[model samples]
Target: MRISGPTDRRGVTAPAAGRWSAGRARPRVLFLATSYPVYEGAAEGVFVARLAESLIPFVRVLVLAPCPPAAAKRSPRARGRKRVRVVCLRYAPARLRLLAQGPGGIPASLARRPWLWVLVPALLWAMFVGARRALRGACLLHAHWAVCGAVGGLAARLRGRPVVTTLRGEDVNRAARSFVHRLVLRACVALSSRVVVVSEALAQRVRRLVQAADPIVIPNGVGPEFFELDPPSRGDHFEVLFIGSLIPRKRPDLLVEALRTVPGARLTLLGDGPERPHLESMARAEGLSRRVRFMGQVAPERVLEYLSSAEAVVVSSEREGRPNALLEAMAAGRAVVVSDFDGAAEVVEDGVSGLMFPRGDADALAARLRSLQEDPAMVRRLGQAARARMRSLGLRWEDTAARYARLYEELLSEHGGAAGEDGMERGGRNGAA
Candidate 1:
């Protein structure tokens, strides 16, 4: 990592390329996302949590998201801090129910009550005021998704702080397809001095759609501490783990069908969503009630234990931008059988690191699972291979944090005192960037 200017510290390296450590003065960044502590959508929430924690080593990061509910304001503590302080909407009555449900849970709730649209502007106003205050010492605005970034970029531009936006899956793949969303997303990416994406495919998409100042591809890195190699033979009954929301996109239903195909195979689905009832009924109807189990919403730390015990972790999502659970499974030396999506292909090279299957094909997924189940040798080989490859990849939290810090510094330097609130200043607000 190269420091843009003469860094104040002697030992710490700037968070630039080729650097392994952080500079002495950690930047204070305000992270805006759709929601935090999101229990339903495991992958996004998990990765976001890791990103925030990883950034903490090089920067003081505060995670700011709209509270899906009114209860977040009155629920428990006056303030809460865990590595990063999670701030929610102070008083949103109609939306409070959504807050109680979760970030993913709120969308449908908002849709059903069309009357709620009238309150969005006021809710955003309150959020801006609260965010501005919480950002008292923040140097830059770092938003996770495009819509939030579009709004936050405007807010940061209002406050004279640089904005760095990261485009994730749904925000780009689905939402960006909409004209309004596409316009806002492009504007957000263009206005901010820095634009970031998780994959090369995404980078190309952005380039084709908009003229970005300097777009960078920064894939989400996994923390090495989260995984450990589990011996292949520990299983009494081959425990197969599927770690994702029970949402339709994740396609947990395919996993159920896979379990049925692989007789005696015990499958654990760890999440909750609108599709739970349908998935549960399928299990009952298929007489798979005994073989398949739905363990809704487990803690992040607890996930590793489940993966550690399972013979292999399966990813059956119709689409993805590099599944974090897939990475974690690989990190744990557990073989992954993922849908053949571009993002999953980035991590899993078929038959080498992990197995790849066609998207939404339960039969294809089952056949792959049977091959691995029948051949323990292949499982061990692939699992060990995946672990070795990931270790070499250096998917550590510090590595992730350092990259963001360097990018932040680089952007601030590049902008060179652009007066736009969303433009990167020579020195970030309070000299944090």
Candidate 2:
């Protein structure tokens, strides 16, 4: 695929023109993700949508995602994101959506409350139906999480489309916990044309599950705006930031514990989830109520403002898939103290870019915090190094989209073209152009 200059009707400017075979048309990508941005202020799955949007200029992309059934009442949040056409399929009833598809994402929803398993069947069935309807003119399928990958795999098998499944952290990490989970994970791997993971650690885990499956590691990226390099706005007291859902896996409580060891340090928690109340209470119990600020759920565009203002960012997660929170912080030139979770080593270099402590070790984390506190110059140096590393790596959404576009072309070449009803290959026509 050659990069050609052209802007599509969707308002996304194509950096390069993409090609399949010599005579084929531009490929069309249908993305399947259980979590996607439904409205403008939605904090969930904005990364998934960003990938789809980036691909729009390179290919025709249509996103088939499930929104809470009640979201129909709100105005569309996709005003500026005109690159991809999003179809929000409803899986649960309005009142039952919170129980079935909680804000913590599908896997976390089920893990936290096992009783919600009752609604899974309906969710999968709905996705299957939606995928079938959306696959009519699409040439390839890209599923974000394993659960959605399972649904996409089934639909692809029926429709004869090549499906690529991207495994984000919990989808594979917790797959072995139950029979259904394992079965779904296997189905996703078995049906995929290629498997993609955000981190090398996750790729190793997938190989252990399916020896034949070799997953490609493509780490998530940060936007250039986040890397604008504003002067450090160190306030009277050190301000640290934590941006993620307050779930058990994220270990926000551990960050709270570490904060107890550092005096005169303030924290800003910038996301909400099921565990917010418990975390809030824990903060209060430790007399950290004044130092901790819970700025629950801000819009995606505003994250850079918080990152630029903070002296450091903390990622104390039990697990991760190359967290965007850490990536954004690094790009914004902020010092970091991240738990050495599964994918942590790939992103942060200890003492080079930032510090990495063993997962769940509050004392180790506190010690690192103390080091940064004692020397403000060290914090500035580390933040600058982190940004420099990110710059050298070229971690941006544009680069990510180009990689995906090439992968789609490779899969398209193997498949020849869209399949006819009789399982015959037809001339490769991307979309209804």
Measure candidate 1: CA RMSD: 5.3
How far residue 47's Cα lies from its native spot in candidate 2, in Å, is 0.7
TM-score on alpha carbons, each prediction? 0.83, 0.90
lDDT of 1 by residue, 1-433 (tens): 2233223243323333322242234446788776566333233355777787656435556767655543334432111123366665554664443432342433533554567566667656765666566555677788877766777777777777788888876666664367866887777776576888887777766776675535687778876665554566746677899987777778889988877889768899887777789988999999999888888877676787687778778989876666778888888888888898766766788999999889989999899889888988888898998898787776655566667777777765565532333322222323322
Which residue runs of candidate 1 sit more than 4 Å off their true CA positions? 1-26, 38-44, 68-82, 94-119, 132-136, 211-214, 415-433
Give candidate 2's total backbone clashes: 5
Worst window of 10 by summed lDDT in candidate 1: 74-83
Candidate 2 residues lying further than 4 Å off, grouped into runs, are: 1-14, 17-24, 79-81, 99-101, 111-115, 176-179, 419-433
Residue 342, model 1: Cα distance from true site in angstroms:
2.2
Query: What is candidate 2's local distance difference test score?
Result: 0.79
